[model samples]
Target: MHLQKDTNPALNTVTAYGDDYIEINKTRHQRSIYFTPEGQIYDLGIQSPFDFTTELLQKITGVCAAAKSPMDFLDHAAPRFENPEQIEVLLIGTGKTQQLLPPELLHELLNARVGVEVMDSQAAARTYNILMSEGRRVVAALII
Candidate 1:
């Protein structure tokens, strides 16, 4: 058997998390956040799942959508991705509990071919780390 090592030492990983905060790469964030496996992190400023609105979701879709893919995340210009293969699914961490979002809210993402996974913040964090380690194109929006 062969083992492949992650070449990027700076890749962000969820280190610790609690009901009120999440630690990524050893830094703590009390607010919600969005992160990619490549170490790109952004504060989402969402205090709860209710703060994760359709507009915010649209922005996320813009960030993750492939340049050549359908413009399904609103009418804004889609962000170009260096590696289209790096984006697969989006993990939504619904704060302290798992919350189901309306299917219509995710319709655009689905049309763009991006899968959605919704879970509690803690579970989402763990899943994000695992998917990232495996070099899957994954993004996480964790509500802390």
Candidate 2:
């Protein structure tokens, strides 16, 4: 969506861009945000009384956000194979470029023993789709 100057002062103009796969927008909060098929943005002022960023990641990964202590979003995105010996990788999208994740969260994931890789949102989505089509249970979070 293109950002246009609104005549109504109450309405803020949000600029959005994307193709068939994903969309990124400059929200009213002035933060560049990403969207998922679940119809939820990464940070869009949802009141849940919890860390919404963490919760969104869990939801996108199809894991029970309440199950574990802040379930590893990456691991949830890329689920474990039926055979424990099989290795899985999670592709996390942080936007136009790979952004740093919360250090504490990263440490937690590493401690839980899951393979994690961070990439830009577009690349992450593409890679995830490729892996899944190849009969891999990989998950991706596209920011935008």
Best by lDDT: 1
RMSD of each: 7.1, 12.0
RMSD of 2: 12.0
lDDT of 2 by residue, 86-108 (tens): 32555676666677676554443
TM-score versus the correct structure, for each prediction? 0.76, 0.44
Candidate 2 residue pairs in backbone clash: 23-144, 34-144, 77-139
For model 2, where is the 10-residue window of minimal lDDT? 5-14
The candidate maximizing TM-score is: 1
- Please give the CA lDDT of all the candidate structures: 0.76, 0.45
For candidate 1, lDDT tens digit of each residue in 1-144? Answer: 112233345788787788788887767788889988775689887777766665687676563444565655566764543324436788999988899888877766776677899999899998988898898888899988
Candidate 1: misplaced stretches above 4 Å? 1-8, 63-86
